[model samples]
Each structure stands twice: as C-alpha cells, then as structure tokens.
Target chain A: MLSVLLASGVANGLLYGLVALGVVVLAKAANAFNFSQGDVMALGGFVSYAVIVTMGYGSVAALPIVVIVALFVGVLSYLLLRPLMDAQHAVALLTATIGLSFLVKGTIRLIWGRQGDYFAVPPLVSGPPIILFDGAVIIPLQHLVMSGGAVLMLALFALFFRFTRLGLFMRSVADNPRAARIVGIPTELVLCSAMVLSLVVSAVAGFLLAPATLIFPDMGFSLFLKGFAAAIIGGMMSLPGAVIGGVLLGVTEVLVSGYISSTAQELSAFVLIFVALIFFPRGLFGGRSSRSV
Target chain B: MKLFSQIVGVMLMTTALAVPAFAQDVQGVSDTSIKIGTFGPITGANYAFGRLTMNGLETLFADVNAAGGVNGRTLELVRVDDQCDPAGAIAAVRKLIFDDQVFAIIGGSCSNGVMAAKEDIEQSGIPFVNFAAASNNISAPEIENIFTSMLTSNLESALQAQYLSDLGVKRVAVVAQHDAWGSDRHKTLLPALAEKGIEVAVDEELSMEANDATAQVLRVQGSGAEAVVLLSYPKPASIFLRDAARLGFTSSFIGTSVIPDPVAFDEQVAVPGATDNFVTISPSRYALDSAEAAEWLEKLTTKFPDDEPHTYNLYGITAGQLTVAALEQAGADLTQASFIAALEATSGLETTFAPGPLNCETHQCLQAAAWIKRTPEGKTEVVGLSTLD
Candidate 1:
C-alpha cells in the first residue's frame, strides 16, 4: 500500500516539478514570474485534444502545433509587456501576469465551455497496468509515461542551458540586465526567448499530464497554486530545487493523507508553506535577495 | 364656450382609452411577448447544468413560438451567468428581477446557488420554477412563489437508502463533497441510512475539482464497507471510481441525481470495467437513447447543433414544459401573481421526461426517480425505478 501511494505521489510530483521548472526559468531570465503558466499548460492540453481527438490526428502531430502556439503566446506577451520588463517594475509585472492568467482562462472558457465538463486525451501508449512486488503495487502505464516525459524534458532543459549560446545570453541577462546590455547582448531578445522556453516547458507538461488529470477549463488554477508552492519550496531560483521540492511536497501530501486524513492533504500545502517561510526564509535552494513581489 | 366644451370632451375620451392599457401593465409582459429569465453557472466547471438546460428551455420556447406561441405572445428568455456561487446567484436573481424585469424565472442548476438566491426570490415574489438542483431546502417549507420540478434531495436520499437495504448491504461508506451542493444530499442521506439500519463504515470528503482520490479510496477500502455512496459531481465521482479501480477496491458504487448521464460518466472514468457495479439515479425515466426520448433528442440536436443529447437537457425541458403549462393555466391576462397561483395548482402534470407525475401543491413536485446502470461492455441501462413513499 505504501509503495503504491509513493508511486502515485511521485507521478503527480513530476508534473508539478515541470510546472515549477517553468516558473523558475522565467523568474530567472525575465526577472518576473509568469503567473499564467498553468493556463498556458491547459491551453496546450486543449490544443492537443483538438488536434488528436477532434481533428483525427495522432499525438505526435499535435506537438508542433502546441509548441508553435505556446511560443507565439509567450513571445506576444513578452513583446506587449516589454516596457514593464525593461523598467524592472516587479509589482506592475506581477499584476500584468495575473491579468494575463485571467485573459487565457476566459479565452479557454469561451472556446470550449460548451463542449463538455471533462475531456479525456488518449494515453501516448496503451497497455495494461504494470504490477509489481507480488501484485501488491499497481502503476498505470500513463503515469510512467508522464514521469519519463518530465525527466526527459528536465534533462533537455539542463543541456540547453549548458551547451547553447541563447541559454548563456538568458543567464547573463538574468544576472545583470544593464551589464549584459552594455556588453552588447540583446537583452530584449533574451527575455523573449526565456518566455518562449518557459511556456514550451509548460506546454510539454500539459500534454504529458492531460491523460492522467483529464482536461477542463478550470483545471489550471489548482495546479498553478500547487506549482507555486513547489517553486517556493525548492528555492524560487533553483531549477533542481524545484524538482526536489515538488517530489517532497507530493510525498508529504500522500503520507499525510494516508496516515491522517484526506482533509489534511488539502491543508498540507498551506502548512508546508507556513513552515518553510518561518524556518527557511530563503527556501532550501533560494539565494539571498532583498527583492520581493 | 364651444372651444372649452370640445377640449373637455377630448380629454374624457383619452382618459377612457388609457384605462385599459394601464390595467394590463405588468413588468415583463408586453402586447406581443413575455420575458422569462434563467440563471446558472454558464462559464464555470458546472456549465452543463446551466448551459445545456438553458438550451433545452430555448428549444421548447422555439417550438412554442413556431406553433404560434402561448396566448399570442412569444416567450423571450433572458440568461444570466451565476457561476454556481451564492453571491453570484443572489446578484443574478436580483438582476433578473430588477434590471431584466422578467415575468417568471425557470432556472436553478446548482443547489447552493439556488438556496442562496431563495430569499431574494421570495422577497421579489417572482414566479420561480426550478429546472435542476435537487436541494430540498430550495422548495420545501414552500416559498409561495418558488416551485421545483426537480426531485429534491430528501426523496432521492430515501430511494438510495432503500436501494441499499434491498441489496442487503449492512455497511456503507460515503465519499461526499463538503460544499452546499454535496451537503444538501449528505445531510439527508445520513438519516436515511440510519433508518435503514445501515452502519456508516467511513465518511470522507472530496473536493469538486479534485483530480486524485487516492486517500479517500484507501480509507474507504480499509473500512470494509459493502457499498459506497458517492455524493459528488461527475468529475470527482469519476476520479474516485478510477482511483478505486486502480487500487483494486471493489464495492457497489452508488451515485445521486447529479450523475444522470451514466454513459458520459463511464467514458470520463476512462477505465475499462470500472463502472460494472456502478448505479446512478436519474430524474428522467427514459434513457437518452430510449424510444421515449427520441423525440426530445431530435428536437435538442436540431436546436443546438453542437450539443449531444444529455439528461440535464431533459431536466430543463421538463421544467420548461411545466412553466408553459402554468402559463396556459394562468390565461392571457398573465402577471407574476397569476403565474404563482397556476404553479401552486399544478397537480399530476406529466412532462413524459420525469419519472412519474409531478405536482407543486407541496412545492416539492418530483417524487419518483430511475436508476441507470452501466454494463461492463459500456452499455447504459435504465435498470429500475422507485417512487419515494
């Protein structure tokens, strides 16, 4: 029973980790949180559903459309809010992103509100549940796919940051926008690229997690809240810390639910946030920064 | 002297002509149309309850208009989105009454939202005919102006408890949402279960938007219950069933009126053979594909080209039929008071979609329900019917 619980926790954790990873990347590069990450993820899932189910295309065929649409939205938002990003007005940027979340949410509601309550995207691969330990633990194949997808995306992100020039430009701008600008780096382009990459990460997470969670218009807010918590726990600027934090949060939630009660699981996020704030002001991985939103 | 006499005569004739028009001055009634307002969650997760039902109402209105309308007046529907929240419902009801000035309202898709707006409806004295929403408090204790054609929670709870007793289930587990929607049914279900001498093995809460039900499933499985009553909307209910299947927890899963569309629910669960032992209550007697419903299905599909036939539509259709009946009974000279009087006098009004006869004498009109079961092969069956005693 414990093993099954842990497996389920980790599976859910990976999805959260992906969302947190996007948040961290955007916060690092653009120096502003992308509050609409969850909604963007939902849009990705809906687009996949449209391509795969509605248009009679395979999952692979939907990927390019998802990436293109996400990239367009990301770049468009950055361009529109370029002045705020340049001014480094953190509060204004935060409010703008929150408004963007609403815009995306409302657009989704308008397009798909009448279709149905929940939509099920077929799994990437179809197979029976994988049983282990003398049939004591059962893991759904889709959950395994989601975990593997999350890991693969994380590795790719790491490689891109380490081996790509565009990645270095983003990192340099994140470190010191004025210095990078003086040193001939196109800070504006770097910020836009960071936004695109962040949204792409979220879109991939959406496609991978849609089968397990199902697709609904209001599905994003809860996930956004969870991802925000995971991001905060892992140290807001640390990519690896986000992954660890998400897994830890997921495991703790499951353990609390299993041993105590389900109600406790809902409250566990708040409790974890409160404890983290009191004990570790900088989080487990966050660096010292006087700046706050 | 001749000029003064002519002016006085003209004034007297004009006053006489204006008296009749003044006598017929009602807020939402005009010489050629009657305005009716409907409110529900049009833009949220519960859009089906609001939007689909509204479509059914519109279809019924369209048919009536095509057939020359009722008493030579076309029915115009004014829709307001309540988003299934109490404050939103209250504001919607007020807007319908004050701003829209609708003669009668035929809506209430969410239990809590409807209950929240009940006070405002009572104060306004507008004729309110609830299409969906099964909370007993919405209609019981009889608000003179409000009448529900939907089966109230009390009657459904009794029928559910009776079903369990007939199955000889001694122990039962309940997984319910804690919101107003779930609380209305859960409160009534507990007493009904106690009456049947069934012990509650476990009681758990699942949120409406919950994507996972692992903890609840595990706790319910550990309780050794013979059956489980799932007092939740379709989303959380399906998630619970899916998690239960994943955990190999086998039990008779029972559902309330909220899950009327068993076929869609089975698909939503996305697990093969997961709903083999699942049974849900429906206010509609006939299944969506049954011969009796073919006419409605055709009518609905024709009216809303994008929508598939659903039981929620039937709920609105039934309420629309009831409203039309009341309007016809109220006669050509219609007012809010007359409509309420007509609704109160409604007895044995059969809509063909509801399980049995409906009456508004007690304000809680619906008393019968049907059970829908999904076979392992994914076929939905209207297995049985029950009328609460």
Candidate 2:
C-alpha cells in the first residue's frame, strides 16, 4: 500500500513539475508570472482533443498540429502583450495576462464548451497495470508514460537552457535586462521568445497530462494553482527547484489524502505554501539571489 | 345623424371583441398559441444538461404542434440560459415570468440553481414543471403550482439503500463528492440507511475533478466494507473503480442516476472486468440509444442536427410530455390555476423514457427507479424497477 501511494504520488508530481517549469521559465525571462499559463494548458488540451478525437487525426498526427497551434497562440499572445510589456509595470502586466486568461477561457467555451464535461484522450499505451513486489505495488502504463514523458521533456528543456545560444541569451536577459540591452542583445526578441517557449512548454504539459486527466475548459484554474504553488515552494525563479518542489508537493498531497483525510488533501497545498512563506521565505532550494535559473 | 350611427357601430364592435378577450385573459395564451418558458445553463460547463434538455423539450413541442397542436393551440417555448448558477437561475426565472410572460415553465437543470430560484417560482404563481434538478427541497415544502418530473435525490438515495438491503449486504461504505449535488444526496442517504437498520462502515469525500482515488479506496477496503455507494459523477467514480480494481479489491459498487449510462462508465473505467459488480439506478428504463428510445432519438436528431441525444435530454422529454398532458387536460380555457389543478390530478401517466408511470399526485412527480447493470458482454440490462416508498 505504501509503495502504491508513493508511485501515485510521484506520477502526479511529474505533472505538477511540468506545469511549474512553464511558470519558472516565464517568471525568469519576463520577471512577471503569466497568470494565463493554466488557460494556455487548457487551450492546448482542447486543441489536441479536437485534432485527435474530433478531427479523426491519429495520435502521431496530433503532435505537429499541437505544436503549430501552440506556436500560433504563443506568438499571438506575445504580439498582443508587447505594448503592455513595454509600458507597464510587472503588476499591470500580470493583470493584463489575467484578462487574457479570461478571454481565452471564454473563447474556448464559445467554441468547444458544449463538448461535454470532459474530453478523453486515449493513453499513449494501453494495458493492465505492471505489478511489482508480489502484487503489492501496481502502476498503470499511462502513468508510467506520463512520468517518463515529463522527465524527458524537463531534461530537454534543461539542455536547451544550458547549452543553446538562445538559452544563454535568455539567461543573460534574466540576469540583467539593462546590461543585456547595452551589450547588443535584442531584449524584445528575447522576451517574445520566452513567451513562446513558455506557451510551448504548457502545450506539451497539457497533451501529456490530458490522458490521465480529462480535458475541459475549467480544468485549467485548479492545475494552474497547483503549479503555481509548486513554483513558489521550489523558489519561483529556480527551474530545478521548481521541479523538486512540484514533486514534493505532489507526494505530500497524495499521502495526505491517503493517510489523513480527503478534505485535508485540498488544504495541504495552502498549508505548505503558508509554512514555506513563513519559514523558508526563499523556498527549499531557493538561493540568495532574486533572479535564478 | 350619420356620424352618430357610425360611432354606435364602432362601440358595439369594440365591446364584442373585448368580451372574448376578457373571457380568456391568460398571459402568453392567444387563440392559436400557448407559450412556455425554459431556463437552464445553455452556454457553460453545464451546457449539456441545459441545452440538450431544451432540445428534448423542443422536439416534443414540435411533435405536439405537428400532431395538430394541443387543444387547437400550438406550443411555443421561450428559452433562457441560467448558466447553472443560483443568481442566474433567479434572474432567468424572473425574466421568463415577467418579461416573456410565459404561461408556464418547464426547466431547471442544476439543483442549487433551481433551489435558489424556488422562492421566486413559488411567489410568481406560474405553473412550473421542473425537468431536471434533483434536490428534494425543490418540492419538499409542497409549494403549490410547482411540480418536478425528475426523480428526487432523497428518493434515489432511499432506493439505493433499499437495493443494498435487498442484496443482504452488510458493512456498506460510501464515497461521495462534497459538491452541492453530491452533498444533497449524501445527507439524505444516511437516514435512509438507518431506516434499514444499517450503519455505514466508512465514508469518504472526493472532489468532482479528482484524478486519483487510491487513498479513498484503500481506506474503504481497510474498513472491511462489502459494498460501496458512490455518489459521484462519471469521472471520479471511474477513477475510484479503476483504482479499486488495480488493488484487486472487488466490492459491490452502487451508484445513482448520475451514472445513467453503464456502457460509458465501463469505457471510462478502461479496465477489463472492473465494473462487473457495478449497479446503478436510472430514472429511465432505456438508454438514449436503446431501441425503446429510437423514436425520441429520431425526433431529437431531426430537431437538433448538431446536438446528440443524451440521458439529460430524456429528462426534458419527460417533462415536456408531462406539460403537454397537463395542458391538454386543462382544456381550451388554459389558466394557471387550471394547469396546476390538472398537474396535481396527474397519475399513472405513461411516458416514453420514464421507467414507470409518472405520478404527480404528490409534488414529486416521478417516483419509479430502474436498476441497471452491465453484463460481462458489455450489454446494459434492466435488472428491476422499484417505486420508492
């Protein structure tokens, strides 16, 4: 029973981690949290459902379609918010993203709200659970795919940020925007690129997670809250810290529901956030610097 | 002298026309049409419940109109979207009553939404035949001019308890969502269980959008429960059953009309032999796609080409049928009082989708519930029908 709980906790942790990665990326590059990140995830899930289920495109075909849609959304958001990003403070920019979130959520409702309570995506693989420990621990194949896919995507993101030219440019922009601007870095382009990168990451998370969780317009807000909590707990600016925090939060939530009470499960995140804010302040792995990667 | 004669003729003609209008002074009632209004969530997450139910009502109205109308007056429906919220339901009901001046109303998809607007409905004195919304409070206080065609939550909960008792199953556990809909039923279920001399071994709460139920399931299993009552929607219920199956824990899983379609439930579970011990109570005897509902499905599809028929649609169809029956019984002089009297007098009326006779002798119109099970071959079969005590 303990092993099963741990496995389930880790599986959900991976999903939270993926969402936190998007939050961390945007927070680092733009110095503003994208309140609309969850809505972007929702839109991605709905688009994938449309392509794969409604449009009769195969699963493999859904990948490129999802990418194209994500790119368009990312670019459009960047263009629309460019003026606000240039003229407004971080708080105002964050507020504008909240508006954008509502707009996107409403638009999705108008187009696909009638689909039903939820749209299901067939798992990447289908079969019975793989039993371990003399049938004590059982994990679904879809869960394994979700956890593994999340890890692979995170690893690739880490590599892109560390070694690539654009990655270094984004890092430099995060470190000191004024300095990067003086050194001939196209700061606006870097910001736009970050927005696109965040959205793309959100789309990937939505697609991978939709199989385990059903796709719906309202699915975004709760997920965004969880991911945000994960980011905050892991030190909102630290990518690796975000991942670690997400896993820790997820495991804690599952265990709370498993051992304590389900009502406590819902309250656990808020409690964790409260305690982390009061004690750690910088979070588990958060550094002394305000900006981190 | 000629002008005086002309004036007299005009006055006489006016008086003649006014007399007949006074004789039949009901709002929304013309010589050729009777207007009824419906309110539900037509454009939000709960759109399926509202829009599809309206589609069913519209199809019935069309059929009634096509069959030479009801009492020589065509049935017309005015629809308003409540968005499945209490404030929205109240405003929509008020608008339908005052602005639209509908003679009657036949809609309410969400329980809390309907209950929130119940005061307005009762005070308006407009005859209402609720199509959906299963909270017992909607009709419990016995409000005049208000009747519900859907089975009440208390009745369904009582029946679920009765089913467990009949099977001789002891040590029952309940896993329920804490949302309004689930809570309403859960509150009623405890008393019903006690009436049968049973005590719940364990009780757990789940969220409507929960992705995992391993914790809840493990706790229930550890409590030595032989049966589990699941008061949940399809998603959470499916997850709980799947997890239970994974742990090799098989117990009799009982559900209510929330999971009307066993076949869909099985698919959502996505585990072989997971739902073998599952049983659910449905207000209707047949699934929307079943042979018994072919005619309803045809009418629904023809009326709404883009929308598909669902079990929620069946609720609307039954409500529509009940409304038409009441209107027909009210005769050509269709006043609100006459309609209420006719509805109260309704009993043992057969409907296409309802499991048994729709009885409105009480404020609760529908009392019968059907037990449905999915066989190993993935076929849904009606096990038995019971009228709630």
Candidate 3:
C-alpha cells in the first residue's frame, strides 16, 4: 500500500513541485506572483504541441522549439509588465497579469484550437516490477524516474541559488532593490533574468506533464491551484518548503481520495490552505517576511 | 382598332389566369425552397460534433440538389448554434421557427439540450428529426414531432452487459460517477447484468470532476470482481485507468459509450498496460472490420476526413436518410404536415445507415450495438454484433 501510494504520489508530486518552483523563482527573487503562471504553462504545452504535432517534429526533437517559445514568452511577459513596473506598487500589476493570463489562454485557443491532441511520446524504459509484498502491488521504472526528476530538480535549484552570480543578484534585488540600484547593480536585468528562469522552469514542467497527461487547455487550472497550495504550505519564500508542500499536497489528495472519497480530493487542499492560513500565516518554514510598504 | 382589341383581349385573359391561383394546398409547397433548420453546438466544447454533423448533412443536401432536389425544389438548411447549452437550445428553436419560418427542424447534437427544447418544438407544429440526442426522454410516448436517430444510454448499457455475458464473465464491478447520468446508466444496465446472472461485486462512485480513481479502484479490487464496468465519460475513464495501473491492479476493463472512442483509446493506452485489458461497447457498424460497413465508410471518409466512421457518424447519415425520405413522402408541395406524415410512415426501411433503416414504432432501433475488441497495438475495434439483453 505504501509503495503504491508513493509511486502514484511521485508522478503527480514531481510535476506539482516543478510548477511550485515557478512560484518560488518569481516570488522569492522578484517578490511578484505572475498570476498568469498557469496560463503560461498551458501556452508552453500548446506551443510544444504546435511544434511537435502540427509541424511534425518528433515530440522529443521539438525541445529546441519549446525553448524558443519559452524564451519568447519570457520576453513577452517582461513587456507585459514593463509599463506596470514604472508605477511599481499597484495591485494593478497582478490584475494585468490576470488579463495576460486570459489573453494567452485565448490566443492559444485561437492558434492551437480547442481539440485534444494525443501526443506520441517515447516509451519509458519499463523494467520488471519489484514486489513490495503481494504481486498485487509492484513498482515500475517510470515511478523511479518521476521521483528522481523531482529530487534532481529540487537539488539543482538549490545549487543554482547558492552558487551562481545571477542568483546572487536576484536575491540582492529581492532583498534591497534600492540598495542594489545605488550600488550600481543592474536590478532591471536581474529581475528580467528571474522572469526568464521562471518561464523556462514552468515550460519544463509543462513538457514533463504532457507525456503523462494529454495536453488540454484547462488542465493548468487545477495544477496551478495545487502548486500555489504547496507554495503557501512550504512558506511562500522557501524553495524546499514548496517541494515538501507539493509532495504533501499530492499525497494528501491521493490519501483523501483513497480513504475519505475522491469527490473530496479538490476540497482537501483548499481546506488545508484555509487552516494553514488561520494558524501559521508564515508557513511551516518561512521565518520573517519583508514586504514593500 | 382590330389590333388594339386583340391586345386588350390577351391582357384580360392573362390577368384572369393569374388571379386566385393559390389553391388545392399545392402538394407540400412552400413559397420557394424547402427550408429545414438544424441546431447544434457549433462553437463550444462539443463543436466537433456540431461541425461534422452539419458537414455530413450539407454533403447529403449537395447530392440531393445535384439530382434535381426532391420534386423540383432545393433543400435550404438554416443552421443555428446552440453552444450545447439548454437555454441556448431553446433560443435556437425559437429562432428556427419564429424568426426563420422553417418548414422543419433536424439534427440537434445534445440530449439534454434537445429535451429542454422539446415543448416549443412540438408546440410549433414543426417536425424535429433529432440527429444525436439519445436520452429516452426524446423518444418517450409524449413527444410527437421528435424522432431519435441515435441510440440511448440504456440501449448502450444493455448492449455492453450482453457483451460481457458473452465473454463468460459471471461477476462484475462498477465504478461510476455519483451523478444522474451515471445512475441512469447503472439503473438501465444492472437489470441486464442480473439477467445474465452476473453478480455485481462492487458498485463505486466517483465525482465527475475527480481526477483520481485509485481509491475507487482499490474498493473494486478488494471486492474480488472479475470484470470492471466503467460508467464514465472519456476524461474520468482515462484517469481511472492510469490510477489503476499505477496501483498495479490488473482487471479486465469495460467502458461506457464515450470511453473507448478511437481518439480516447489512444489516450487511455498511455496509462501503462491499460491497453491489454481495455474493452468497450460500441455499435457494430463503427467497427473497422464490419464488412457490410465498408461501402458506407468509403463514402463517409471521402466526405469527412476528420470524422471517423463512428456510430455518431452513422447517426448523421441516418438523419439525412430520414430527411430525404420525409421530403419525398411530403410530395410535390413539401408541407410540414406531409413531412411528419413521411416520418410516421417510416418502417423497417433498409439503408446504408447500418440498421435496416429505422422503424418509427416501438422506437427500438434495429441495429443493436456490438462487443469490444482491442487491437494488438492498443488501438480499439468494435467486435461483431451481439445480442442486447
């Protein structure tokens, strides 16, 4: 039971964690929530489909095109906010991102059209399953890959933040933008870099999910909600917190669907989010939060 | 003076002949062309059905027109977009009748939407040939002008139950969404299963919007059932298979009508070993191997490239057959009453529609559905026709 639960949890948790990274990349470094994050993820999948399916590039071979689209989306997002950033403190920036979300989703609908595309992904190297107890439950190679992908992404993200100059500049901008600007650090470029990183990470998440779940336009909404729940549960500012939050959320959904009922699966996370907000507003790990007053 | 008298005499004769000429009900005559209105969701999630249905209907109309149309007049189709919504459907009916002044209505894509429009459609004294709506409500005794061209869920489940019986399965499990649609299917299907002496070991419910059906599957697995009957649409059906595979549960899986669709079959096969055990209930004619269906498919594919030769595609063609037959029966005048008379006159008429055409009475479609078969490479095929319990 444990193995089966974990295996199922891993496939879903990995994608959720990867998406949560988008939140961390933007919120932690730039103190912005690109409300269009989910829509952008969907757009990436559609763009990938357009390249791979419509253009007849093999699904795996379409990676270069995916990266190009991701970069373009990043630049487009920057342009979307460049005007808003001039004023800076208005909640209207978030609202504009919401508008951007609709525009992107609608544009994708117009360009890709609304039909389910069954992508032909390469077969995962499946191996003989290892039995936990009864032959009823066995672990497969794909489960391991999913778990490994999540752990590797989490570790790599941590390392990137710890060891890189661009990462350092992003943190400096997030921490003290005025000081960084006075010190002659190019804060705008740092912010732009943060947005691009977020976009690339989200695009990767989209690609990862497409192989498992057929790409649908409305797919990102539920995923986006779960990712946000993980971000909050982990402490909005902590990357590790987001990963734990995501895995916990995925497992919680499965468990609730298993033990209580599947109907209550969606309601579980929202209820958890509400309870967490009431009790621990700073999340389990996030200590002190600084907001621009 | 003689020439002037002759001219005046011809003019008087012409006026006398032209005056009071509109008499004798003129066979089934309208002012100009025979106007038939159609309702379908042209721009919503179900737009594919609507678009393809219209395409098929137009192809038939084109062919009819090429043959000098029914009794010297062309068929003019006034199309309306219902967006697959009930209210939208009601408005569509109102517009088709009150605004467009159509002679008859045909080919609505959804069941519930068409059911909601039943009252106004019947009240308007217009004949409605329902192209795709399959709920029993449309074909029940009360609605007069409505004629169903698609098979109902009840018919589908009975067909599936009988198919499983033929597979020698003695016990089955059901995982259905906790909703009216699922419950209606369960109600219709369980009796058929009981008749086959197949005990239902587990009956489970999952919400329509639920993404995971692992817990539901575990319950079914624990019940020790031999075969699993999935009462679901394609989305939840695919999700259930994925969750089941991940949990490493292996059981023969049977699906609802919408579940084992060719497009959906490809998606479900991605669910790790789901292809091996997957089976579904579909009409026999949609089966690629149906030798009798060959010529029909040849014509359908030539006309509609995107639309596979599915049961619904047959329904569109059947609608065309009925429409043309009705127009012909309506005679030279082509009145609405004559069209309804033509529809009522429908019997065990044979056509390329798979079934020996449709018998208007008992509303029992002669073409019973078929057994589920899986291709070696995970593509699905509808097996040969079997008895429906």
- The candidates, ranked best first by lDDT, are 1, 2, 3
- DockQ per model, Cα: 0.39, 0.44, 0.22
Kindly list the per-residue Cα lDDT of model 1 for residues B1-389, writing each as its tens digit.
67864564454344334434575567788988999999998777688889889988988998888898889999999999999888899889878876887888999888889998886777566789998888888888877888998888888999999888988999999999888778888999999999999999998888876666777888889899999999988878888887777667889999998788788888877777678889999988888778888888899998788766678888888888888888999999987778889888999998878888888889888888888987655666888888766
Off by over 4 Å in 2: A55-61, A288-293, B1-24, B245-249, B267-276, B374-379
Error of 3 at A289 (Å): 9.0
Q: How high is each candidate's TM-score?
A: 0.87, 0.90, 0.83
At residue A77, what lDDT does model 1 achieve? 82
lDDT of 3 by residue, B147-189 (tens): 7666677777777778788889998988887676677788888
TM-scores of the candidates, chain A only: 0.92, 0.93, 0.86
Q: Can you write out model 2's per-residue Cα lDDT over B37-148, one digit (the tens) per residue?
A: 9999998788887998899899989999999999999999999999999999988987887688788899998898999888677766778888888889899878887899
Predicted candidate 1 versus true structure: per-residue lDDT over A1-293, tens digit per residue = 67767776787787788888888888888778878889999988998989988898998898889889899998888876777884558889888888888888889888887778788776677666689888887776766777788888889988988889998888787778789999999877888888888888888888887766578887887887788889999898888988887887777787777778776788887798789867778777887668677
- The 10 consecutive residues of candidate 3 chain B with the worst lDDT sum are B11-20
**lDDT, candidate 1, at B87:** 88
> For model 1, what is the error of residue A38's alpha carbon versus the real structure, in angstroms, after optimal superposition?
1.1
Q: On residues A109-207, what C-alpha lDDT tens digit does candidate 3 reach at each position?
A: 676554532333332334454685566666555556656655766777777778988777777777778898899888788878777777777776666
